[model samples]
Structures are given as structure tokens and as C-alpha cells.
Target: MEKSEFDLIKSYFAPLASGYEEAFDLLNDAALISEKPQASTVVTMDTLIAGVHFLMSDPAGDIARKCLRVNLSDLAAMGAAAFGYSLSMAYNSQIDVGWVKEFTTALGEDQQRFSCHLIGGDTVVTPGPLTITITCFGSVARHQCLKRNTAEVGEDVWVSGDLGDSAAGLKLLNKELDVSDAEARAQLIHRYRVPEPRCDLGIELLQNAISRTAMDVSDGLLADLGHIARASNIAVELYEDKIPRSAAFSALMSSSPDLGLALAVTGGDDYEIVFTSDPAQEQAIQELSRKLSLKLSKIGKVVSGHGVRLICRNGKTFLPTKAGWTHF
Candidate 1:
């Protein structure tokens, strides 16, 4: 017997709404939210297509987590705490009851881990590729959310975690690059599959007034930073040597230094936060990083200019052939 859409939702997704009373056990047509007097809701949506955002060969569980986490990354960029998310799925013949079970189970686990819950959503059959869209909602203190345009000249630009591993991982998965080291391969693949959202760090930055301007690094560092530059009406200068990279990524660079460096700056899918803070806040930011046990790299500075500039280790300006990822 084939499971109907309603049956699939009841058996798999409804349980994920367990702790959220407003979800009404997935029986109601809509979910409700009560006002938080001193907070504002932050909503973000991201859609993932099977072939475009992720590989069809990837596990169902990872695909589900990636969909949720990427939206969560947006919330983190705004320094908000995630509360709930509504998900919509367009499934193809490739997805069966077993696949739904695995997908929803992963979402359930991440909900608990991130202190959020499933609120409401829809599911439908698609003749095309399987697609997942998630609209995540979070809350921040009233009038305290971060914005890219708030950056000021002389403020230091900082980025959380390393970059480019996800791009490297993609190459590895596509067989464009071969890494014999088992550990390095696994690390890069994991980074590509599951990006760790800097939720805690974002919250701290906002609540403590450490940074006023920020955004998540989804579209490569250089491209994403360009967004900040345009928004704030300023230029940024980054030192190539200062851009953080994981040890595995650094080791991989040893084989093809130019390619590795380009990938690190121009590769997308790294969900780390890029923010700017006053130089006076430097020690405090460093202390916060130590307390959270997350690496925070001071990579660049905002200046009175138009765009981003990259300085090579040899004291020369480095020009990249490509700025970042683009879908056209």
C-alpha cells in the first residue's frame, strides 16, 4: 500500500512538532505565535534543489539538515535565536517512505540541538527534481539586530571559522580532486555536508554589543564581503595570509597553492559569520571567542572606498579571476 501525503506527514513530520503547542500536532492549517514584548521576529527562507544545492547521491538525512541549517545560518547572521521553522518539500519518485523517515528524523534531531521546532509546512509531488524549502523564524532583542550597512570605517572585519573546505569537499565528491588522506577527505566532506552555524557566537555579539554589522558567508568570502562593502558604502582590504583555513585545507593547498588560495577566497557554502567591530572591541571579541571555543579571525578592515581589495603575502595586490559563486 502506498502512503498518502497526509499519512506521510502524520507518521514522520508531526512528531517533530511535539514540543511546539502552537503547531497543533499538524492538525491546524496554521501555527500561532504570541508576541514577545521586547523581541522582534526574524524570518529567513532558503530553497535547495537536489542537483543544484546538493548532490542527488547525498544521504536524505544530510540533505534535510542542510536545508534547515542554511536558513538557520541566516538567522545567526542577524544575531537571532531560532525558535521554529516551516518546511515545504517537493518530492520526486526518488523519495519514498523510507527516505521521508530518514529526512524527518534528521530534522527532529537538529530541532532539539538548535532549540527550535517544526511549526507548519506542506508537501507535494514534483515531476522534476526533489526540492526542499525552509522558512526559519527566530527572535532578537527589539531594535538590536545586526545589519551590513552599519559597518564603519576603521572597524576590524572578523570571520568565524575557516573557509573553502566546502568547495574543496565538492571537488573531492565530484572526483575533480583526489585526496589520499582519509582524515582530510572526511573532514572536507563533512564541512560540505554539514555546516556548523555560529548561533551562539552571533547571539553573544548582538547581546554584548560587540558588532553592529554582519552577515553569514554563504556566497564565498570575497563575494559576500562585497555585499557588505556595497551596503556600507565602503571598501575592505583583506590579507591573503590572514584568511583562516583549516589545517586540512592548508595541507591541501600545499599541493596546488594557487588553486587552493583561490578556492578559499571565492568558494561558497561556508556558513561562518563575517562581521565588523570597532578596534576598541578587539580584546572583548577575542575573549568571547575563547569563551565560546570558536575561532574568530581578524582578516580585514573597512576603509573609505568602493570595493574589496586582496593583498598577497608578497606585499602585492592579488587579483582573482573570479570573485565568487554565481547562479545565472
Candidate 2:
């Protein structure tokens, strides 16, 4: 005899039901609870398809973590604090109890890391690839939240950490790039498998008002910068030499400069913060970073033009054959 679906759901979730209920306490009012009462809520949603966003062969645990992290990255872009989230998972009959257990375990870990409670969600059987849709909710002080359209002329543009790690990591995963060093290979693979959203840096930037506007680098730096440019009605002059790259990236560039930089531009999934600040905030940024031990680097400036231009180290401009990635 086969077990009924209700029996299966109960057996799988029974042991963890109490913890799940605790997490869902925030959802009682159709709104996420916030510690800062005066802050306005910021909500975002992201969906991941197994084949498009991850390998069908990928571990359910990793897929679960990445699902939540990607949503959190959007909250970080708004400089919001992660408070809670809900999820919907669609799995085929091919999935097993073991897979659900692993997926929930990863979700639990991410819930802890992001300081977000897992509110409530639904699980259903589907016919195709695994699909996970996560809705994340966060909060930001009314005056502190950053917007893409808030960029101003003469502000210094900065990004946290290096860009293109995920892009290179994906290349390595696809076997398009060869890494001779075992350690380097491990680093790149980790970047691809697990991206760290800059929550701490984002909150710090908001609290100190160090930036006028901010966004996350997800769909490639140039693509994301284009969003700010379009929204703010201003152009950006990005110094290609200033775009941060990992040590491995520099090694690759030494052999093929053009290809390496192209990967940096067209690649995606960096998740670092891209923000702008005027010179008046320079000393404040410096002081805050020193106190917090966070690394921030200036990469460009807002200009009077319309689109993005890559300026060389010697100040020559080069236009990209293609600006960045597009999802259709």
C-alpha cells in the first residue's frame, strides 16, 4: 500500500513543525514584523528554476541556500535588514523525503545567517524541473533607505569587494576555464556555489548615510550600473582599471587581458554593493570603514553623459560590443 500525500507531508514535517510555527509568528498580520517601528517595509521576490538557475544534479541543500541568498541580495540593495521570508517549492514526484530534509536544513542555516525567520510557504508536486520561489521581506528607516534613482552628479561610485568571482566561477563550472592550482579551483567553486550577500555592509552604509544611492551587483556591474544611470537620468564613467577583480582574475588577465575584462563585464552574480557618495561623505566613509573593518573601494564617478563608458588606465574609452547579460 502507498502512503497518502497528507501522511507524507505530516511525517516529513512533524518533528520540525514547532520551529516552523515559531518562525511564522511574524506573518500573523499579512505583514512582516520589524524591530524598527518607524521604518517602512521593503519587499522583494525571486524565483529559481533548477535547470536555468542551478544544475538538476546540484545538491538540494545548496539550491535551497542560494534561493534565499539571492532574495536577500535584493534586500541588501535597498539597504534593508532581513526580517523574515516565505517560500514556495515545486518538486516532481522524483523527489524523496531525503531531498526535502536536506533542503529544509539548508533553509534553516540561511534563516540563521540572514537573521530572517522562515514564515510560511507551500510545497507542491510538479511535472518538470524543481522550482523555488522565495519572497523576502525587510525594513529600512524612512530616511535611510537607498534608491537607484537617488544618484547625484559628482558623487563617487564605489563597490564592495571584487567583481566577477561568480562569473569566473561559473566559467570554471562549465569547464570553459582551466585552473591549475587546486586552492584557486576550490575558491572559485565556492564562489559559484555559495554567494555571500553584503548584509552587514549594507546596513552600515544605511546607518551612517554614507551613500546617496545604492544597488547590488547581480546582473553584472555594467548592467546594474545601467539601471542606476537610467533611473537617475545621468551617465556613468567607469574606470575599467578600477573595477575590482580577484587575485585569480589578475593571473588570467596577465595571459589574456581582453578576455578577462570581458568576463568581468558580461558576467553576473557578484552580489556586492554598488553605491555612490559625494566628496563630503569621503571622510565619514573612511572613518566608518576603519571602525568596522570593512573594505570599500571607489570604482568610478557619476558624469553628465547618458550611458556607461569604460575608461582605460590611461583614460582612453572603450565601448563593449555587448553591454551585459539579459534574461528573456
Candidate 3:
């Protein structure tokens, strides 16, 4: 039986948006968004395609979570709290109603977890692989939104959560990396499939005035630091040893130390928050870490110069073949 787009929306997507009065039950062509007092809306979008952003064989529910989570991560970088999102799904012939049910179920779960709703979306058939695009909306205090890195030369650089687990996870999924421990392999793969966005940390950074500049680490740490340097017109001096890694990632890359180091900074997809702050805030950041029960590492500093410089333990500079992921 062929299901019309309206049928799918009425059955699944509409329920996701029902809590939001502005969504109009997904019956209208456009949904209305009511603005909150003294709040600025933050908008970000990400598109994930089968085999490009995720493996085709990945579970439908996992794929749905990944698609929404990536966009939410962007909002977190800007110190915004997610409110709603509009989805555009371009599904290929291989996708069916069961896959969509699994997918929307996951979206519903995350929507509740994040306290956001789906306002509207479009469903279309495509010859290409399954593609999911989400334009996520978030809100922050007026004039308190974190923009590009406003890092000052000599300020400390901090990143929330560990790095490289996702990259290592991808390698394991692709059969390019090997880990002897079954648990480590499972952890890495999970990181690749699901990312934890640092939304709470972002809100604190803005509301508590911890930092004025921040960005989510989507690309490798080095590549993203370069972005911060360019945006703030400052150089970054990174201490190689300061990069954070989970027990799982360290275990997986234990045998290949060199590869492990490279993957830690260049692997990307960690979805952690990286921000520059005054050195005085170090203690405050530590307190926040304890309060939030999240790991926050000070890995580098904003320096005077151009680009990023990574200093190894041997007092030598380590250069990677690639800085981060390049879409082209």
C-alpha cells in the first residue's frame, strides 16, 4: 500500500509538533513561531546523506537522532536553547513506512529529551540515498549569543568532553582501525552514531558570562581552532598532551600511538564545545565541570601569530597531514 505524504505527517510528524501551538497541527503550509521576550533566535542547519554522513546499514532510529543532534550541536555552540526545528527528508526507494516509523520514533524521543518540537517539514522521494536535513531553532538572551570566537590573544582555550572517539569509531565501522577489546569497540561505534551536544554548557557560558566567544568542534580540533584564529584574528598554541580522550578511545588506539594522536585532534565529529575564556575563569570553569558532571579540558591558549601551533611533549611541533574533515 502506498502512503501519501499527508498520511505520514498526520500519523507521525504531526504528533511530534502537537505540543507547540504555533505548529497548527501540521495542517497549514507554514508554521508560526512565537518569539520569547528579550531572546534572540539562533538557527542552524545540517544535512546528512547515506554513506556520506552515515552508513546506509545504520539503524533508522540512530540515523534520525544523528541528523537532529548535529544541528542541535550548532545551536549549543552559539549558547542557544533549542525550541523547534523543521525537517526535510529526501528518502530513496529503499526507505519504507517501517523505516520512517523507526526514524520518527527516535525524533520524538530526542524532541522530548531536548525540550524541542518539530514545527513543519517536507517529505520527498529521491533517486539518491536517504538524506535528512534539519533547520534547528534555538533562543538565547538578547545580545548574549556567542558568535564567532572572540578569543583574545593570551586567553585560555577550553573544550568540553573528550575527542576522537567518534573518529576512531568511524574507522572501526569502516574496518580501517582495530581494537582488541569488545567494549572499547562498542563505545567508539556508539560515539560515531550518537553525539552529545553541549547545550547546557553553552547556556551557562552566555548566561553566567563565562565567555563571549565559542564554537562547537565539528571539524577536527586543529581545523576548528584555525577557524577561531581566523575569526578572532589571533593565533592558537595548543599543548598536544592536553587533548582529552576517553578510556575507550585511548584503549582502541593504544597500539598505534601516532595514529591515536592524529585521530584525537583531526578525527572530528566529537560535537564538543570549544571556547576561549579569560585565564581568571579557570576556577569557575572547573566548578561548572563539577556541577554539570562533564569533562572540560583546557588544551591551549589564544596566542599572537597566525594559524595553530601544536607543541608536543618532546618540545617539538607536531604536524598532521590533514587538519580536519573536508566535504569537497
Q: What is the TM-score of each candidate against the true structure?
A: 0.97, 0.89, 0.97
Q: In order, what lDDT does every prediction score?
A: 0.90, 0.77, 0.89
Where does candidate 3 clash, by residue pair? none
Per-residue alpha-carbon lDDT of candidate 3 for residues 1-328, written as tens digits (9 for 90 to 100) = 1689889888989999999998999999999877877877888999999998899898999899999999999999998999999999998778888988999999999999999999998999888888889999999877568867578987999999999999999999999988778998988999999888888999999889899888888888888888988888999899979999999988777788878888888888889998999999999999999999999999999989888888998899876555443421
Model 2, TM vs. native: 0.89
Better of 2 and 3 by TM-score: 3
Best by lDDT: 1
Poorest 10 consecutive residues by lDDT, candidate 2: 23-32
Candidate 1 lDDT by residue in tens digits, 220-306: 888899899999999999999999999998887787987887788788899999999999999999899999999999999999998
How many steric clashes between backbone atoms does each model show?
Answer: 0, 0, 0
Model 1, runs deviating above 4 Å: 321-328
Tens digits of per-residue lDDT for model 2, 1-328: 1444456545543333335455433334243253566778788999999778777777888888788898898898888998877777788875787788787788777777777766656667788888989898888886568789988889989888778777777778788888888787778767777778888777878877887688888888888888999999998888888888889767755687777776676577888889999878888887766875766788889998788777987778767665453521
